[model samples]
Target: MTIAFISDIHGNFEALKAVLAEIDRMRVAEIVCVGDVVGYYSQVNECCDELRRRGIPSVLGNHDWYLGYGGFCTRSRSVNECLVYQRKVITSENVNWLRAFHLQMQMDTVRIVHAGWSDPIDEYLTNPSEDYFARLSGTHFVSGHTHVQSIHRFGGKTYCNPGSVGQPRDGDPRAAFATFDGETFALHRVAYDMQKVFDRMEAAGFHDYYYGGLKTGAKNLRRLAD
Candidate 1:
């Protein structure tokens, strides 16, 4: 089965729409989102609703937890401010849906998480050693959080990050995602109408940092390189 993996959408409906369009074109059998579906952007509800409508299986993200449990104040001040603004706009139903998501999921030979399987929502496997990857139980472990696209092979397992779909930090502005067909994995970078997402953020009165991140995927790449 061909599985399409995406993550770190951060509520950019335009980017998500573009990615979905591409996924539809590819005709993948399954689409899974790694998480962070409701942070840093203005269209949380729209994004969540579309994911629900499509019946995509998604893992919960840290941002989703912070938004649902009113834990924003304890997180990063900037992220707190963004969540506060997001809370004002997101619907109660969407919040509940985010709350219901699991931090990790396993299907056949594949394992999915917003971060690493070891810590799920909190730990990043960006620089995991061979021992670390070997410890993971799945043949294919997929995660996204550092927002850098990479495929790492260790021992007998494959670890992958599809990067960020809406707010890529990988220095490349193009939207990043990946596809796995059991034996092979392919990374993709697709261009979207960033100006449209920027305009929506402005119209919604979201903070500039959110929109600024979309202009370039530099932040994500920097984090990965670190």
Candidate 2:
């Protein structure tokens, strides 16, 4: 069975729609989300509702935790600003759905989490070493927190990050996702109408400071001087 893995879909419906459309074309058998269904953008409800409608299972992400459980993102005020806006517009039912997400999930040989196993909803699993993968309990592991798409192999174990569906930061502005065909994994990128997202953000009273990095997929969120 072929499975599609998506993560960090921080409410960019345009990106999500494009990714899902591509996944549809591939006729993928199953789709799983690593999480962050809400945060950093508008249209949180659309993203959540689409996932719920498709019955896609997701692990809990830090952003989802912040909004669902009520907490501030101490690391990035921009994240908190987006969360504040999202909270006002998201449906209570979707909030409940976000609350129901698990920190990690295991499906046969595949292990999935929104971030590192040690800190499932918050850790950034970048630059993982062989020793790191050795401690993991599965043949195939998947997580997404850094918004960078990559695949690593250590011994017989494999680790994959599907990247960000909404806020990709790997120097590629396109939407990012991945697919696994049991034996191997593949990362994929597709372009979406980012202008539409920008327009929506502006309509919602946000400035370019909120979405300037999307065009180039900068490593950090863009500031006015950037």
Candidate 3:
């Protein structure tokens, strides 16, 4: 079976739409999103509705927790502000759906989540250690936080981060995801009409930095190199 893993959508329908288009062309049999379905950008409802319509099994990310429960997280002020805004605008049904997301799911050999295994919902792993990877019990443990695409191997198992769909920070400046056939997994970064994304952000009154990051994928370029 070929499974597609996508995460950290953050309400950028353009990016999500672009990635899904590519996935449709691939050999994907099952698709799952490790969350953050509503944060940073403004089309929270559109993003959530699409996922709900598609029936993708998604785990809750830190931003999703904030939106679902009116709680605080370690995210930046701008991100928290975006979540605060989404809290007012998201439909009640969608909010309930977000609340129903699990922190982790296991499907045969695949272990899935939105963050690290330790804390699950809030931990961010930029370069997770092999020991940490070993602790996860699966042939493939998949997660998406830190907005970077990578895979760490320990023994015969693989730890994969599909990167961020809405807010990729790996310096490639494109929407990111991963696909797994029965044998191996590969990462993909797809380009979209980012100007349209910028226009939407502007219309929504999001800060300029949000659009700037999408334009350059310049966030933490140094950390990505390390």
Steric collisions counted per model: 5, 0, 0
Q: Which stretches in model 3 have alpha-carbon errors above 4 Å? A: 221-226
**Residues 1-226 of candidate 2: C-alpha lDDT, one tens digit per residue:** 8999999999899999999999999999699999999888899999999999999999999889998999878877777888889989988999999999999998668999998989998888889888998876779999999999999999999999999999888899999999999889999999999999999999999999899899999888684110
Per-residue alpha-carbon lDDT of model 3 for 142-175, expressed as tens digits?
8887888998777898888998888888778889
The alpha-carbon lDDT assigned to residue 127 of candidate 3 equals 71
All candidates' TM-scores?
0.93, 0.97, 0.93
Higher-ranked by TM-score: 1 or 2 = 2
Model 2: lDDT of residue 89: 95
lDDT of 1 at 71: 69
- Please estimate how well model 3 matches the true structure, expressed as its whole-model Cα lDDT: 0.82
lDDT of each: 0.82, 0.91, 0.82
TM-score rank order: 2, 3, 1
Residue 154, model 3, lDDT:
77
The clash number for model 1 is: 5
Q: How many pairs of residues in model 3 come into backbone collision?
A: 0
Span of 10 residues, lowest total lDDT, candidate 2:
217-226
